[model samples]
Target chain A: MAQLSYRDAVARGIAQEMRRDERVVVVGEDIAGAGGVFKTTVGLLDEFGPKRVLDTPISEQAILGAAMGAAMTGLRPVAEIMFSDFFAVCWDIVVNQIAKTRYMTDGQVSLPLVIKTGNGGGLRFGAQHSQSIENWAMAVPGLKVVTPSTAEDVVGLMAAAIRDEDPVIFCEHKGLYASKGEVPDGEIVDSLGTAKIRRPGRDATILALGMMVPRALAAAEDLATRGIDAEVIDVRSLVPLDTRTILGSVARTGRLFTVEENPQLLGWGAEIASIVADEAFWDLDGPVQRITTPHIPLPSADSLEDLVMPSAESVASTVEKALQS
Target chain B: MKLPLSEHRYGEHGVVLPPERSDANDALDVDLDRRRQLYRSMREMRTFEKRAYDLFMKQLVKGTSHLSLGMEAIAAGFGAAMREDDYTFATYRGHAHTLARGVPMTPVLAELLGRANGLMGGKGGSMHLTSVEHGMMGSYAIIGAHLTIANGAAWSAQYRGSGQVAVCFFGDGTTNIGAFHEALNYAAVYRLPVVFVCENNLYMEYTSIHDITAVPHPAADRAPAYGLESIVIDGNDADEVHLAAVTALDRARSGQGPSLVEALTYRHGGHSRADPGKYRPSEEVEAWKAYDPLTVYRERLVRLGVSEDELDAIDASVLALVDAATEGAIAGELPSPESAFTDVWADGGWSWRN
Candidate 1:
């Protein structure tokens, strides 16, 4: 096993897929020679050359639209949107065009492409730049939303997204770019909708995604010290959700809490909460709780941003108070 | 291992020049056989669109449909100019473009009728007509977006060493949108083989394109900004558009980069089935109808010594084909209730759970 950072894992994943398939190509603004603004796609241009790793104008619609068109013709494209919030500029390409192309064309054209974006709110880039839009992608019908919490998952899920014969919204948290984890040396690939039980416990089920996973695990650790055992499940892929694992966990632990970086009201947690309420209602000992940023535009100030977004300390305290109550 | 770069395939046919002044009666490179084929394509598209309008008028076609009633020449020209493997991305007014790619009329008609035998099995109606096997990639309902998509197809062709050219068709309104400029710049920067054809049909939906647009020729006027020559032509003249299409296609296939051609035409009908088109001045409509593509082409053929009987025979045959397509479409069955659940993913199922 090799220790790799989250950002390096992204480049590794893309390179692995590109090496395997001649049809694979990557395109985005500053993703080629500049190695991407977040530095996740470093070395792709030199490795694959300019033909495969293309640097496009600062056009989100162009980046995604080209990716969709390329995928329609014949190419496994991984197009980056720079920032997840920029999907607003070209949401039509993503939600209406790419997401619905396969179903709309009656499977005549399958878009084997991945939309990689730096997602989440921890970097303090403010409201426009930093927003976890996975919930926005999940709301779409024909899209597969994937958020990898670890370096290994970053490589594996990205590989899976590129290989899959459908458009995948792969959200790489801006906060976890520097985070490191042990990744198996050779090619690594993981399924889209499988949740990993990071820390298994019996008292409560703590569901998290992207940057929230680490904090949830840390909170679980804090809860363990206080005699409140918490189970942390990294909810990797939202659309093809691992309901079996979630339901099974909820069944074991009568309490459920979702840790999410997205703002409250229609966050991914609400959907999970709704599901647990309907299916695992009988297994629940108390009402489901969602720990998320308040329903407000994220502030860039470090203290205010830290206060708004959920952290390990906040998660631990919330879980402790909820379990005690 | 990395893939090798592609070399140019269209060696002899280099840059294709537009008519010096956008005249209809420019010196033509077309022969009688080519003219006859172009005439057939135009006739087929014309017949298909007329039948589609008739169906919409009868309330048989559900939802809404955008018809290319008077915009047949542009589709015919590009469809003829493109190879069998070339890709086409058109707007919602795509029935003609779809038919031009040689997709049979029956399935297209059936799709409008929302039948199981439809092109997309009734999943995609008139607004989303697509036949990838025929190289008609898709008919995007949203404006300006397909331009960028065409660039991607071109990029793929360039990457894979394929000489296929991607042609995108949109209306005059799209030229004002950001994606149009973005796509043009991108295509030029990367030197991707793509042709952007703007059917400047005088209107952008309900609004007059001239009123909202900043430039005179919506697409061609802005071509120079992206290092492309601004070429405008009489869309009513099939030969003129055909020549322009050949030029752009050659330029793209030969690795000369992208072209933006503005084909000036007017739609005989409203944007969609919903509009009665009272907003258009009667005299303006009358003047444009007088210069209709089919009428102009028919006159040109006659002036070139083609017999009246031959043209009549072609039109009659086209009408008969449209009739058969309509009959078959009317008889086509509705999609099975369970069929809607399929094709949501590559697994051919809609399940989102493990």
Candidate 2:
């Protein structure tokens, strides 16, 4: 095992994939010479050369469109959208083309492509850059959405996404880029739609996604001190959700709380809560609680941003409320 | 103001027409067998489109379908110019494009009829017909969106050191979209092997190209901005389109980079099946109809010493082929209800429950 930063782990995964498969090419704005804005693709240009590592113009539509075209013609393209907020600019390509191609073509075409983008907020990047809009992509049926919190998950999930036959939206949290964790040596590929139980308990189950996974784990630790055994499950893949893990935990604990950084209305957390409510109605001891960002745009100021986003304290308090009820 | 013939307008833009093949030497230089094949392709497209229109009018086809009534020459020309391995992308009016690329008429008709035997298994319908085996990437319903995608295909070919060239068949109005500009710029910068074929059919849906475009000729005026060599041709003339395509494909194969060919043609019918095209002036339509690509090419074949009896035989064969395809498509089965749940993911596993 080797300790690596989340950003380094993602780069390592891409490099390893490129080395293994010559068809894998990376395209994005400033990803070649500049090594990407977050340096997640650092050293790729020198190792793979410009042909494999392409720096496109500031047009997200062209970047994604080209990637889709390349994928159609037997090339595995890994495209990086600089920020998830800018996904709106190329919504037609993503929603109509990339997501719908395989199904629309009736399996005649397979788009082995990956669209990696920085998601979530914490460092005051403002409304446009900070919002976690995984729910928008998650709502789309064909797309596979994966958000890795730790360095280990990033490496494994990134490798899996590159090798996946379908288009996978790999959402890398900007807040976790500098965070470090021990990753297993050699190649690691985690299956999509499988959630990992980070901590095991019996009082209630906390399903966390993206940046909220760490917060949920911390909250579980806090709850343990107060005689509350809270189980924390990190939802690695949002689209092919591991209902088995989530429902099993809910069945044991008889309580569920979904934590996320996105808005509460029609958010990823709400989807989880709805699923638990529908399937495990009798399993729940109380109403399925959702700890998420309030239904408002994230503010630019640090204080206002802090007030909007969910925290470990909020998760703990939400769990306490669910347990009391 | 009425739009003049595209050839007449080309001189005003200082666009020099490629040297035309003289009629005297055209018979000797052009391969007789290839010319016959090109004529056959045009005839098949014309018959198929007319049949599709009849089906739509009879309420047999489910959704609206676009016809390439007068734009058959461009499709036949590009088909004659490209290899079977070369990738082709087209706009919504792409039936002729796929037919010319060698996609069977039965599956093509089946797709329009939304049958299980369709090219996309009744999923894509008319607007999204694709045959990857034949190198016809797709027919994008969204206008101007496929330009960059075609550019990427060309980039992949170049990266792999493949001699293949990617071709995009779009309309004149597509030039006004931002993706067109972005795609052209990227293609030029990367020296990708792609040919942007704009079938300038005068109208984008109901509105004339003059109303939407700033420039009269997109290929002649705008292509130069991206450092691409642009050629303006008489789209009704199959020989001219074929010559231009050969030149562009050769340039792309030789690593000379991307080029644009704006084929000046006119659609005989409305953009979609429903409209009667009341927006067009009757005189203008009549004037353009005088130069129907099929009629012009049939006369050329007669002048080139092809017997009238032979031309009749070719026409009869095409009609028979179209008839067989139409019957087969109508008799095709409907997709199963469970089919809606499949093909969304490569793993054959849809995340959502039924």
**Best by the DockQ measure:** 1
User: Candidate 1's residue-wise lDDT over A1-325, tens digit each?
Assistant: 9899999999999999999998999988899999999898899999889888888889999999999988988899999999999999999999889988889889898899999999998887999999999999999899999999999999999999999998999999999999999999898999999999999999999999999999999999988989999999999999799999999999999999999899998999999899888898999999899999999999999889999999999999998999899
Instruction: Point out where model 2 deviates above 4 Å.
Output: B1-29, B352-354
Would you list the clashing residue pairs of candidate 2?
Answer: none
DockQ for each numbered candidate: 0.81, 0.66
Model 2 CA lDDT for position B165: 97
Tens digits of per-residue lDDT, candidate 1, B1-354, equal 000001111112121111122233634778877888888899999888888888877989989988898888999988888999999999998999999999999999999999999999999999999998999999998888999999999988998889999999999999888988889999999899999998988788888876777875678779899999978777877887898999999999999999988887789999888987877777667766776778778877887788999999999999999999999999999999998999999999898886
Error of 1 at B283 (Å): 1.7
Interface RMSD of each: 0.8, 1.9
Give the alpha carbon lDDT tens digit for every residue of A244-323 in model 2. Answer: 89999999999888898998899987888888888999998888888889888889899999888989998898788668
Give the CAPRI rating of model 2.
medium
Backbone collision tally, model 1 = 0
TM-score of chain B of each: 0.92, 0.93
TM-score of each: 0.96, 0.96
